[model samples]
Target: MSLARRASAEFAGTALLVAAVVGSGIAAARLSPGDVGLQLLENAFATALALGALILMFGPVSGAHLNPVVSAADWWLGRRAGAGLTVRELAAYAAAQVAGAVTGTVLADLMYGLPAVSWSHTDRIGGNLWLAEVVATAGLVVLVFALARSNRATATPAAVGAYIGAAYWFTSSTSFANPAVTIGRAFTDTFAGIAPASVPGFVAAQLVGGVLAVAALAAWYPQAGRSADAVVVPHLTEETALR
Candidate 1:
């Protein structure tokens, strides 16, 4: 696919992913007032379902990354092998993903009759939360690349969705493993939103986790770079393959 088409797919995918997250949180809060556990369950289920569906919908076009860390990992792991995105493509994908995330948050808020930019005040800072972010993000990176390396790329949509859903319950930070999503969630003060002040710590933790995961993958699967083209899902065309 052309860079324009791939970047467009990333934008749309990330937008809908955030919408699922924030919108579901809003609906869950309204639907199950005062029951935090049930609300979280509702939000997790919706997000998982939406994530799987969105990956299936956009994977063939753009790999459905929907996250900056995923895109960066793809580029980093595949650079030597020339199998994944170039530096230029990574920058474009990250920009598009972040923009889409913000747009998605706005859309979700508007759908719920809320302000477009409420600015979340849910302070989610702490050593435990930061540890959770690291664990969540590292696990995500490992799962994504490991599947690609093991020739299970076709199962990514379902597996990734399941892992994230599970992580929501296990992780203290509710697994906002994606930096773009973290930034987007700052735009809303709803259930899924993280305070803008908390974004930096979460993002830093996520990046650290990603780097650690990549190092582990490099050690375990020295040849993993060969499969980086299929991270998330194979979206490369014959034309791009030749490039």
Candidate 2:
């Protein structure tokens, strides 16, 4: 596929993923008023199902990364083998992912009759939350790459969705494992929003988690790079084939 087409897919896929997350949170809060636990359950369930569907919908087009860290990991781990995205493609993908994320947030807000760009006021900073982000992000990275390496890519949609749903309850940060999504969530003050001030910490912690995951994968799957082209999902192009 052309880079433009692939990047477009990334943009749309990431946008819809964020919409699912932020929109579902809004719906959950309204539907289960005064019940934080129930609201969370509703939000997590919706987001999980949306994620799996989005992946299935766009994976063949752009690998449906929908996350900056996932794209970065695919690039870093596959660089040596020349199997994943090139540096230029990585840059494009990240840009699209972040932009799409913010757009998604706005879309969700508009859908709920809220301000399109309401800055989030929710404070979500703390040691525990940061640690949770690390754990959640690391696990995501591990799961994504491991499945690709082990030739179980087909299971990623269901497996990843199930993992995130579970992590919502298990992690203190509610598992905002994607940097793009985190930044996007800051645009809304609804149930899923994070204060703009808190975005840096969450993003930084996520990056750290991604780095740690990469190191662990190196040790556990030394030859994992050979399968980097298939991370998240397989979408081979003539360009990658030539590489």
Cα lDDT tens digits for candidate 2, 98-142: 999999999999999999999999999999999999999999999
lDDT of each: 0.93, 0.93
| Cα-based lDDT at residue 97, candidate 2 | 99
The digit string of per-residue lDDT tens for model 1 on 137-209 reads 9999999999999999999999999999999999989999999999999999999999999999999999999
lDDT of 1: 0.93
As a whole number from 0 to 100, the lDDT of residue 225 in candidate 2 is 83
Error of 2 at 59 (Å): 0.4
RMSD values for the candidates in order, in angstroms, are 1.2, 1.2
Stretches off by above 4 angstroms in model 1 are 241-243
